[model samples]
Structures are given as C-alpha cells and as structure tokens.
Target: MPAQPSPAQSAQTQLERGNGPEPSTLDAHRCQEVACGNVLRDLYEGLVTEDAQGRLVPGMAQRWTVSADGRTWRFVLRPGLRWSNGEALDAGQIVASFRRAFAPATAAPFGELFDALDQAQAVQAGRVAPERLGVSAPDPRTVEFRLNRSASLPALLTLPIAFPVYLPAVRRHGAQHTRPGQLVSNGAYTLAAWTPQANLQLRRNPRFHDAAAVAIERVRFHVTEDAAAELQRFAAGDLHITEVVPPQPLVSLRRRFGAQLRLSPYLGAFWLGLNTTRAPFRDAPCAAGATRCDDRALALRRALAMAVDRDKLTRYVTGLGETPAYGTVPPGIAGYTPAQAAWSDLPQAQREAHARALYRYAGYSARNPLTLELRYNTSTPHRRLALAVAAMWRQTLGVQVRLRNEEWKVFVQNRKQRAITQAFRGGWIGDLADARNFLAAFGNDGPLNWTGYDDAGYRERLARADAAATDAARNAWLRAAEQRLLNDHAAIPLYFYTSKHLVSERVRGFQPNALDRHASRWLSLSP
Candidate 1:
C-alpha cells in the first residue's frame, strides 16, 4: 500500500480514468463487461472484496465462518451499514438482492455462477420460486448461505453478481433504478452523472462505512473505445490512467512514457470461438478407434486450431508482452496446472503440414477451399488480429476467410445468440483467481459458453471437479476437464493477455494485480 496524499498536498482531488465503451447498464447483476464491473465495484460493496493486490478482504461483512461440512456459510455485517441514500441497509435486503439476481424473470446474465447454492438451479429454471434460494437473513446483521455442495464461499461472494442491491430503489423505480439520481449504492462512491458512450462521473459516498479512509473525492471514467485516441488523451494529460495501450506503437510509447507504461500478466485468455452449434465446426459421432476417429467436423476444427501460428500472431500483431497460450487457462494460478493441446510441442512447419492434411481429410483442398466468416467487434487491434488470423489460415490451409466487424453491443448479442456467428473473437478474464473460472466457461451450461460446445463428458468432468472434497482431487478433475476440452478442439487458444495501461506519475496506490482490479477509493492524486 502507498501513503495517501493529504488534501493540502494534492492540487486535484479527482482522478480521470480512460475506459472502453459505455456499459449497457449499471446494475451489478445485469452488466457483463469488465469495464462495467470496474465501475460497479466502486458503487457497490460485496460481502467480500479484494485489496489493492487483488487478495480477498473483508468488505460489507466484517467476518464470516463456514460450517465444518463446508455447505453452510455465515457472514456478520459491519455495524451501521447504510445505503448511499442514508437508509439503513440490513441483512434482509442482502438476501432479497440475491433472490432478485437468481429470479427467472430477472434473467441475470451470470446467474449460472450461483448454481452451487441450494435450489439455485431450480429457481433460475423456474422450477421453484426465487424465495426458495439458499440465502437467508438470520438476523439484521447476519446473512447466511446454504449450498447444496461444497464451494469457496469467499471467492463466490467476491463476484459483482453477488453484491447486494437496493431493493427499495428497484421497487420504486423499476429498470430506471440504475440511473444516476435513483441509483443507491453502498460502496465508496455514488453515481453523480452519466452520458452514454461519453463519460460517467462518480462522487465519493459519504455514507460508505469506510468513507473516512477514502482519498479521492471524485472519479471520472471517460469512454475510450479507440486505443489510439486513448493514448492521445493520456499524452495530452487529460487522463490519469488509461484502460489499454495501442499495441502497434508499443516501442515508441514505451520510449516516450517510460515508467508511465504499465504491463503485467493478466488472468485472461484470448481465443477464437468456433460455433460448434453450426456447420463446419459441429462435431459428429466417431467410429470406434484406438488412436483415430473419422469425424469431419472434428477434423475441420482441429485443422483450424492447428493452422494458426500463435507465436507469430503475438509477436507481430499483438506486440504486447503476452505468452502464446496452448491451453484455455493462463499460467500463474495456484494449485492447478493447465493442459495444452497435443500438437503444442510440434514444430511450426510440422504443425502446418498436419493441419493441411486434416483440412484435406475434412473435404477441402486447393480446388475447393472451405469458406468461412470471422466476426469481431470494431476495434483497431481486433481488426489487425482478425486479418493476421485470416492470412494465416489462407496461407497454411488455403481456407477462404471473410472478416466482419460490428459495434460492441451488436457483436455481443450476435455472439451470444450464435445465429450468425461462424467464427468469432472471444476472450475471458477471470472473475476469481481460480482455474474453475476459465474452464467452467466451456461447460455445456456455462453462462459465457458462446461456443455452443455441449459435451456430456466435459460436463461430467466439471461436475466431478466441483464436487471433489480435497484440493488434489479437485485439481485432477479440473486437469482432466481441460484436456477433454482441448482434445475436442472446442476453441483455439491464441495468447494469454497482459494488462497494458499508461498511468500518470501523479496517481498513487494503483498496484498492478493479475486480476487487473484497482478501486478508486484506494487511489490518490498527488501533486
């Protein structure tokens, strides 16, 4: 932790941060983007939160304990907790918030995350009412959760979807509860103003429990979808921190900004998601075989996965200090080792030859190459990466590729529906510092499983992993699940992401973490 600057020592009490496009909503349970999570963390405090280094720390809950069986958890809230509106916030409201998030009518995007809770799956499926959820308020200051199976309650609670919402505001204003004037939060900040696709202003919440320790009085998040434009803003001293740096000008930016440029390993994976629910990528039953299978769709997917040169892509197109990912999960997670594809150790030339053979086996050749469309969101880096990938496939496998780009919102919707998406750019940033967060996304019912990979074997492996009682047992199951995913060629892993940003020297307490989470409450603007 860094020393906080006193009001007299700092000339400005507000910090400006560059971010991506506007969040679709400010509701913690509904919003899905990382940028939205960043803002929501400041406005709403979960029972468990992270410190500057992304380690789990106490937030609204002062302390918590789990039962010996690990199926039940209890949390004791801090004294005198209140919403930004100055109304007393009690444990009952917390329970109500959890129920609202899991209600079938709410359709929370990440509702699957709470499947561990007792009756949660049934509640989300409309089989049971939301009131049947496992969470309960034992007393005004105590909230309890009963899980049907063992899970890390602390890690689950740290996610934004687990954060409590103000039910009164929602009841009074409906969907408009998230608007600036109506939004009532309990974190270190309150929504002051918002202009979509432009910027949002957050002022310090005096009603926050730990407001006395907060240093920055205001945080202004400017929408910076264009990395080049964001870089210019940073160079012009208009932003104290940038969301991301353009990869193409890395050499010059590093030379110009020096220590101001921040790059650190991130717990994320950039991958290409092949729509397994559609043609060319869908899998079929394979004949009984010891070491070979005659599945055309499987062959096509493997060929596409092997054709790409991830090392070259990272070196030339990304330019950022990223590792070529052979597996879905990135490195550095504790107690787990990621499994790579079988061809990961093969030479590039040999890999290309194998890919070409597979392509031919899948009924494609120089005379009749497979034609496919690759979709990605409109951005400079995304365009460059798509072009590089297209060129790689064309050169290595003689595949005809078409590139299409859409805005952020439309792109997300299309990807989720998977109706028009053949192959699309997809990535995952870990919500928790756990391997489960990455591998679970490939599960048949995974909330973020946009690839439409529905494998009973894969789902079984994940279930075993989640039910394992010991760490070693759990890790083995996770390893097996990852291997299964890789063998199926469900998605092509390109590179592990590295967090890139430009931080002005005046900003203090902006510690870099693998999770890339930095709250404004801990940051101070120094003179």
Candidate 2:
C-alpha cells in the first residue's frame, strides 16, 4: 500500500487580511489593521469579546464586576489559562499589558485608548512612569482598573491593544518576540511561519483556552494588496476567504459564486487626511512660532474637501454597495447623532463655485496654482478612487494634485511620522462602537492625529463629552465637537465602506457584523 500522510498533515483554512499585499506587524500592541485584529483575536484573549452578532461576551475574564461609580472595574480570570508556551497566563500579565499599551516606550499607536484611565495620560505624555498607571493585580487571578471617570469601558477592553502581553517572551526576545519561531501566544493559533510580502502560516495552538472548540487545524494569510489578485487566488482555490471582491468582477462573481460572495455594511469611513503640520498645509510650519497656523491653510483644505462628490464615488467607483459619508461617525452607532459635514447640503454648482473661490482666496489660480500630492495604500478600488478624486480636483479647483501609492504596512508607518507626506488616504474600521472611538484619534497629541489639528475649544468639547453624566448628554457634546471638526476641515469625508468577502462554500459559521470582524477560530471546513 502507498504510504499514508500523518494525522498532522491535513487540509487548512486560508484567508487574506487587507485588500493588497502588505505584511502587517504581528505584535498585538503594535498591530492596527482590522485583518490583524482578526488574527490577534484568535491568538490572544481580551477581557471581553464580541460575538458574531456584535454582543459582548466573556473571554479571558469569564465574568466581571464594576463599581457603581464606574471608575473601578474588577476582572476575574478564568482558571487554568495558559500561554502557548504553557506558562500560566494570569492577571499579572493582563496588568502588565495594560501598562505597556500606554507606556511611552512601547509606542503603541492605540495609546489614546487609555485617555480615560487614571494617570495614563500623564504616563503616555512622558510626565509620569508607566508603573504609575492605575491598573493592578489584586490577586493571582484578579485584575483591577481604576479610571479617571465613570464611563463605558467594556467595549474599550475588546480592542486588540488591550490583549495581555506575555512578558516572559517579550523580555527574552525583546522586539523580535513576535517573530514566527520565538512567539508565545494564548489564542486559538500560534505563529508557524511568516514570509515577508508573501504569506503567513498559523498552526492551531493545542494549548489554547478553548482549543476543543477551535475547528480549523491550520490557517494561512496570503499577504496581498492587489484586489484583482485576491480574486484570482479565490478562483484558483488558493484562498478560502478573500478580503475584497474586485470591483470589475464583483457582479459576475456574485452570480457565479452566489453562496460564497458576502456583502454587508461595515462601521467604517474612508476619508482624506491632511497633514496640518507640513508646508502648504500649514501656514507657519514652525513648531514653537508665535504665529498660529493661518486660516488660509484651512481655506485650502475646505476648497479641496468641497470638490469631492461622494455620491458619484460611491455609485460609480465603488461597485460594491457603500454609503456616502456625511461625517466621520457612521449612521447607526449607538449613543451618537451624526453631525452634518461641510458641503453635505450644498447645491452642486454652488459648492463648486465656493470651492473655486476658496482656492483663489488661499492664493492659488490656474496661472500659479497650488500643487499637492494625494497618497493611498495599494488596492484596485483605492487606485480608482484616487484617480477619480484627482480628476475631480483638476476639474473643480484647477489645483495640481498628484496621486501616490504605497503598501499597507509601509503606509501605516509613514502616517505615524511627525513629518508625514503632505496629504494621505485615511480610514477607520472602528475598534469600538462609539463616536469618541472615531474622534479620539484626532486629539491634539493623539498618536493617530498626524494632522496637527489642535484647538483648545475642540479639546474642551471632548472633555465635556467624556465627562458627561449620561449617554444623552455625552452624545450632545460629541455632536457639537464633530461639527466643529468638520467646520475646520480636519478631514475630508468621502464614503462609508461596505465589506465584500469571498467565503468558500466549505466554510461555515461566518456571520457578518457591522464591525466586519470574523475570527478564524469560529470557522469550520467541511471534510
């Protein structure tokens, strides 16, 4: 008889993260992509998690208790939890991870998530030590968080950055701990191999907390930025799930693979981010100068923002269903009322005329026009959208706008630099369901606020909202704050995204949610 394959050698589930070929970071503390979140969720457990229906469910802490004032929270860890290396994963690790997330040295991009925790802001600002932050381990199995104020926190705990960091692995390997072979994880899968710019292999972790319930034995992430290429892989039977359905063949594929094609609205927005600290975008461009950023710079931004036709972009360029974005916060997030963005209600001709006038007022004309570059990450849909917007700018404002593209990981790193490229594409698939979740990243010194948008009035409004006594009051203040940001033209709202994925027929238990988060741990493949 022919030699039989070992039991370990079996069929695997394959998936893709973003729309293109980009190798995102693996460290939960540093990772930011939604796809990265998907994998990290499988690899690490948070205090709480969202079910496929978007409801919060118990995770590392099987159950929790909150103080009446909401400033103190106590999480009781599930017993016998162990890391992939078989070390006890306890409250101490959870406490350490929370501290590391806000520690200035760790440089976690989502550090702003700790804005509510006591003394974390000071620690994040380098004014205090990370050890001074409020989280502590009251016992071997209990982690407590003391907050600055009483507000919603459960949703915040579900963020990827909140995942416990296994300190022993980090200390041993330093920055390279998350590398394939040296990793120690506590999730459904462990890193098997990572080939830069090609693919990443993940083997099911036999030591996972819920290992018995994890159906998929193996998983592979085919790193790619090309939407068309992803479609090709799906057709070739290489990818079991593709991140984006190519715009060109979306309709045909829906008909050809009816059961495999999934389309649903996601809680996200695609917009244009202007780096307000740079030349042309900033009037003074001096950090310590007495002269404030000129209003004319904002005028230029408003001119460009008004020129975008979101309705056309959603209908023509985005073949998959998407809604025109009037504001940063999408329509259905609980406790938030959408604020009217600039030019949302203006007539087409009037808006065009106003944009041209603003451009002229900002010292630009056809003879001596202001030129700028537009940057975006790789993806066919992104390319088409950039081109469409470029054409609109040329037609409406007569300004010279060039289009540029970069891979996802490199692009994210670029966006974080203080001296970012003049203008770039930015979007957010929310880490939590709240208006602040969308707005917090734009704070004066927020890690994601590369734009250098600092306004005392806006800051006050945010503070008021965060401290609001009730959800209703909180939302009112948030709405006002959002309106102020739009008036300043902090970012150009384009369109809200709709997720379209290619799920193979063999897979099951993939339920769509507004967050568009689907962890591979919950999935099973037919024999």
Superposed by TM-score, candidate 2 places the C-alpha of residue 182 at a distance from the truth, in angstroms, of 0.7
Candidate 2 weakest lDDT stretch, 10 residues = 11-20
| Model 1 lDDT per residue over 1-527, tens place | 99987865444888899977667678888877887888999999999999998889999999999999999999999999999999999999999999999898777878787768999889988999999999999899999999988888898787778988898889999999999999999999999999988999999999999999999988999988888899899999899999988877578877899999999999999999999988889876566774665588999999999999998988888988988999998999989999999999999999999999999999999999999999998777888899999999999999999999987888888988888899999988988777888877678554478999998899999899888989889988999999999999979999999999999999999999999999998899886
| Best by the lDDT measure | 1
Score residue 45 of candidate 1 by CA lDDT: 95
Model 1 has an lDDT value of 0.89
Q: Per-residue error at 307 for model 1, in Å? A: 0.9
Tell me the spans in candidate 2 whose CA falls farther than 4 Å from its real position: 1-9, 12-21, 283-294, 418-420
Model 1 misplacement above 4 A: 1-11, 285-294
TM-score of 1: 0.95
lDDT of 2 by residue, 127-151 (tens): 9998899999989899898999885
